[model samples]
Target: MNDRWMQGPQFLYMKEEDWPYTSRENYHAISEVVSVIPTSKFESWGKLLRVTAYVCRYMDALRGIKRENLALSSEVFQRAERVLYRHIQAESLLSELEFAASLRKVAKKTAQCSSIILSMKPYLNENGVMRSMSRINNAKWLNIYTRHPVILPDNNRATRLLIRHYHDKFRHIVVNEIRKKYFIPKLRQLLIRVRKHCFRCKMNVAKATPPEMAILPEVRVSAFTPPFSYSTVDYGGPFDIVHGRKIEKRWICLFTCLVTRAIHIEIAYTCSTDSFILCYRNFLCRRGTVRKMFSDRGTNFIGAEKLLKTT
Candidate 1:
């Protein structure tokens, strides 16, 4: 490593290529921020910044300003949203939603009002924000914004972005918290759509994938074999059996035929190698010979097999 490299600045931000998914509204705000914020201070920092670093650093672009001059942290995001709304209006996109026909006592025939907005009783506030007219408009105890919540379009792209901004800023989408500021038509459906689109939330609520079936083993697939030809052995339980006055503990050594699905049970006195060997002999004597036996690697079963092989 070059020793002179240590002489450079401790921390620096390097700019990078354009972010494709960045909204046009935010892009304009980024431009607005870039115009006021000087790049000369970060001369040591590279010209192009990484995508992630850009997002992080953009938050603090106005950091060095004097206390009195510094804009509120929220103003940056609000400016972007305002720009977004302005762009929507210039395009005449939400014409039906812009004005409400039911606001006045007598409805005008020329007024173009959407059927969806009739029940909402929507009106424009002093700030020109579209808000719902509430019966509690006289309620001085609550905040004015709370009394008449901002009405948002259900299907607009801008509406989704605005909702995302609110959700990210506060981190909760609770009914009361959101109702204080905004209201949407069929809010339940809108929230569901938002949840579906969210990358992190969607991951947590993802649908479970069904496991694929495995290929059948040779013994199980062999249909022509007779009963006890290919046997699978397994222990059942240490069941209580009354012998005269005293009760004795015994295990059922279950032997099942793979081809015919016939089962043969043998009572073992204990779960030892000697007891298992005796059970195996009894099964063979009564049910004839077994060409192959499949079982889990239990200590008794393994020990019995080893002893039989050695003898």
Candidate 2:
């Protein structure tokens, strides 16, 4: 029937008691009722009430003439609920078993003796025994048969998991925390490896590796070059001196031959442009004029260069 027919006085005014009683005849009326029922009402209902209501509505929508169809519908619903519950339980159990297997693999790897463990043999209650047992002396300090099954070695699989889970903390922090509950052989090494490879730790702490050295400049590497032909100049410290019963300061202007590695030092009374010009004059008179000079961007050197250019 059309929605207009259902909305008319015939269906709208009809009492629940007057509606079709059997499932075969009540299909249209059940559909209309289900469509009009608010989804909120279904959500608010208890599980039992919800299941009951669902089954009743389903049975009403069935078109079979036999009364046994209602019983079959209830049986099918119950069976489906049981199957769904079993499926969920099976999935959960399967996941747990898989996790346990992974842990067992980790345990086996941890139990194996490594080079580091063998090195500790001398410290095993047999030689150079100390007064107190520490984590370092694993042979005497750890019961491998019992602890190995549960605890991993310092650089093993379990330690990696702990480092990643704990945000790649420092080795001391990770080792100290693990020591409280479990003893892992060479735990420090394992933690270090984890921290080294951990993406977060690498991003935060990694440094750029130095690239290969570039070819030396021609002025620095050339052979048989005259001294001071290519030179670098820089000012050194002011040295205290006694002159006429008064303390005075003098600066050393250092000129270095880039190719020959020869050095020339001249004393300057002050770090002014005039003083630098005088120093340069003394260097040029002694060593000849340099073809090129390299100096830091000092104001005195700049002024001297400008004076030389003008002269």
Candidate 3:
């Protein structure tokens, strides 16, 4: 249907009702109908473009179909959609791509006069609609849409509506197939807008990105340090240990070196300050004195630390 555009009316499909631009008066009539839309919902053309970028509400802008009808067959809806798309391209995009179409002649070609549309090999049909030419013309196995796709304006109202129309149960995956029939600029941006506005998908399907971890502290990164030089102490459980015949509960004081991750332990029979002082004394004797000591604010540890500072 698209490759036949330059070949004239012979290759084109035009039914009586689908001819939105049968004459000058008829085309204006259709445009006027579309222009007479409610100003409240669409404050300006910009507003319409923004709204349609995700979800479209301008269903009856041209009164092309009776949307209020209870049941509309998929065939009728698709046909009306094709008519609407062509009408939209005729209204705005055709004029934008006029220079690109004129570039078909080598005489009109200029290095200074370049357009993005020209890169897509854009051409104007009999109705002055811009459609892009594809390199897959020799592949008879492919469909007409794959051979020549219509070049649509980026973030336009018509383009938005078409994207929303195809956005069904598949969600974002449909963008791949949409490339087959339309040459919309920044199509990924359009898909991003769709994803952002789609509340259901954003809430349920979107994954959270974890933040990066911070750098290690000086104590953990320091090298060439003696065992227990930069060390932290903590007291663990009252494990049962048999002393002669009777079993006794004992607490273990643990010391860990930050750099080398060396462990040293001392047994304290009770949780009293005297018992902890004896246990810390034994750890210092075996593991050597710590250059920096780190420990929780336990009363027993605090008392032992006060004595060590006083000494």
Candidate 4:
């Protein structure tokens, strides 16, 4: 029956029953009768767009069916058409697209089944058995086995069961025999190199380095202002010469005159505590005694600081 009017009228009737927008003076009267329905889960704009497209396609398909005069038998197509029309009235594009895509998937599955039946002879039996060559071959083999009953390799008959059971073993035996007959013996073989750890040797070589600390030259020590007068002292350079070969590691002593802002940098042969102390004392002698100095918390500097405090 042409029940398209149900889409508009029924939708309006249902909305009225729910009393969705009746919050005026009739609010109490509406609320007494209307139970609020839960909102729809499909709320995304993209989903709506997809559904709309589906409905459009389904409606197009229904139009085609109508043009061909095949609407009577195509019940599903008709239902899809009604649904598409409803979605169109609702202004939901995504719902139409989603439904159309679903219908297309069903059509594709039906086509696939039809194709399979066409390709395979005696396709489906009345009992729903799909007749194929492999099944027919197995049936023939069973008939032969029942009559003859010969003692093959597996019970002396090269049947499907025996073939399946020993196929992999038979394949390996054949390949190995072929290799024995044809493979060259005197050829030099390329061996693959595999890495393996020698546990004993690894344990023997596992020794820890001495805990000698060498601070990087840039580790700055904050000096207190005016009331606390201290200069920041740190190590400097691994300097690169224009001609000399670059050293992997080198050390230089650095002293900053906090008051004068005069920087003293000396290349250190070794960053020993004695060497650092000598550098600090030399700075004090050259440019008046600095009562306090700030430097990185390295072993050498800490030791020098302690020695200066004692003196």
Candidate 5:
């Protein structure tokens, strides 16, 4: 209802504290969008969950970064910004009007920064082929410092700090990761040669006294006698989301018979105790009663199991 709220940030990121209130709005928005737009609605729901996860992580990171006085866009900061933008869109933190206005500018700046860093990778081969800085051995510090001077201006303290950090992390190191990735074939060839040498030596050497082997005491193994022979009933069905005022197309709950491995399935209009009980009872009547059951600890399943046992 406040015009000032709309004008605060073009793409406002919501904190977890705001979730209770915003969820109502998000639910209504999703309903309106899903009813009219025939696009992949489930994808939108997945994005909502993803955004929530990202915001929670980012906010926590921001607290630490702010405390240390590090800039968000600094190369040395070492957090991926592309992921952040994706989170913003997924959470629907911004209204459609505000989102459309500011998305391009912020996204473009983040992408430009990434490109600048990506271009500074050192060329390892003499043939002008660009290789990772990690591939060159012996003089890694000198190689990176010389090749990526564009990223490290003498005057920029942040750039200087980044260069120092990079050196401290990896300078003078023979990068085993590069060797593992690119030199596996060479290692295989060397292994074959060594194996041949071992075989020849084994034939020439006199046989040494074999070490005495000792037999250990026998241990009894328990026979796996399961409490229940098998699940007499099994079923699988769709679960529609109905709580917290968010748009959800549907989810699935699968059931199985432990013993017989028989399956029953139904599509749920909404995932509720009633829906679960109806489907489960129908399955039992058709197949048979199960001796034991295994299901995800969802509320519906737990409640259904309790009610079923009572009857």
Candidate 6:
């Protein structure tokens, strides 16, 4: 090959009409360069070439547009960048597939006749062989065997790539997709490991631990205490009461004994401080004065407490 071709494609003073010829020449030069590189580097080199082409196109489009058209130039550059980014992502996926394929090959050889398995022959039982019979029947199952015997291996990088491709779906979904072609041992564990490390999945995962239960107070747990020693008060309802031709609304104050779980109900015509005080007086007369009282922090309860304290 000529030194000019070896030096790679260079466009200098080229006319618009020469683009077709120049592109062909560029392709030829790229092929020559690619032939010398290792197979592993091919995907990366192809991605670089695509990005270069996109940048060149972007520059060419910008050249035709006026300098005053900043918006158009920005838009063109952004679109080109997006395309380049996508190409890079695709190249990464291709690399992952290649690595997984290599692992699969190694695993196949190991499964057929591995020194590791022979070493563990003393420990393997008839049950083990019977359990592995299904796996042994299928050559595809060999993909799970790696350098070790008891500890099965998987292409974690490839599995993660597949999971991300499926938008980080549940373990069962990913397992189903993988089982379509290859058998991966502990697939659920593998998926869980990937998802646990995934930033998006971790952020979206709900906390597995439940909220701690509040500690029980002394009054609720004390044994053999009097029924009205400590009481909790709450209001319930607006029941309709019919007297002759007139219908009226009534409310009930519920006083629950913290020790004995006993409840005392008092009637109130209105949810007012005076009405609540009367109800409290009735409760004191019937169940005896409570040493401690718990309430729902209602306005009527607060007003009644202040009135009782003053009286």
Candidate that would win on lDDT: 3
Candidate 6, RMSD to the unseen true structure: 13.7
The residue-by-residue lDDT of candidate 6 on 1-311, one tens digit each, is: 78667765555446666755434444332212223323333333234444444454545565574445433345555444334333332333333223223445554443434323222321221222101123243455354332112212244343344444443554437766555433345567777777877788776776778889999899889887778889999889999999789999999999999888899999998999989988988999998868899997899999988987897
Clashing pairs in model 1, backbone N/Cα/C closer than 3 A: 14-48, 14-49, 15-48, 15-49, 16-48, 16-49
96-189 per-residue lDDT for model 5 (tens digits): 2122334454644443343322333422233222223443456555544233221112222222232233333443332332233221123334
Cα lDDT tens digits for candidate 2, 127-196: 1111123344455565442222222334333234544554334433765555554445666666667677
Best by TM-score: 1
Q: Let me know the TM-score candidate 6 reaches against the reference structure.
A: 0.47
User: What does candidate 4's lDDT look like per residue over 27-108, in tens digits?
Assistant: 3422110012111334332343344444444455745633455333344443433332232322322322232234455534
Q: Give the runs in model 3 whose Cα sits over 4 Å from its true position.
A: 1-33, 37-80, 95-130, 138-144, 154-178, 185-231, 236-252, 257-263, 266-275, 289-292, 303-311
- Order candidates by lDDT, high to low: 3, 1, 2, 6, 4, 5
Per-residue accuracy of model 1 over 1-311 as CA lDDT, tens digit each: 76448665333333344323445564433433233333333322122122223433445554543335343345544444433333433233244344452444344333354556556677654545566788898999998778887666666655555556555555555555778877766666766676777787877878999999999889888877678899999998989999999999999999999888889998889999999999999998998888899999999989988998999
What lDDT tens digits, residue by residue, belong to model 3 across residues 57-152?
234533453456444445444444444455566555554555555754552354224546567777666645567777887998887677777788
lDDT of 4 at 160: 21
Give the clashing pairs for model 3. none
Model 4 ranges with Cα > 4 A deviation: 1-47, 62-229, 240-249, 257-262
| Alpha-carbon deviation at 148 in model 5, angstroms | 40
After superposition, which runs of candidate 5 have C-alpha atoms over 4 Å from their true positions? 1-229, 232-253
Question: Cα lDDT of model 2 overall?
Answer: 0.57
lDDT of each: 0.65, 0.57, 0.68, 0.42, 0.41, 0.56
Instruction: Assess candidate 5 and give its lDDT.
Output: 0.41
Worst 10 residues of 3 by lDDT: 49-58
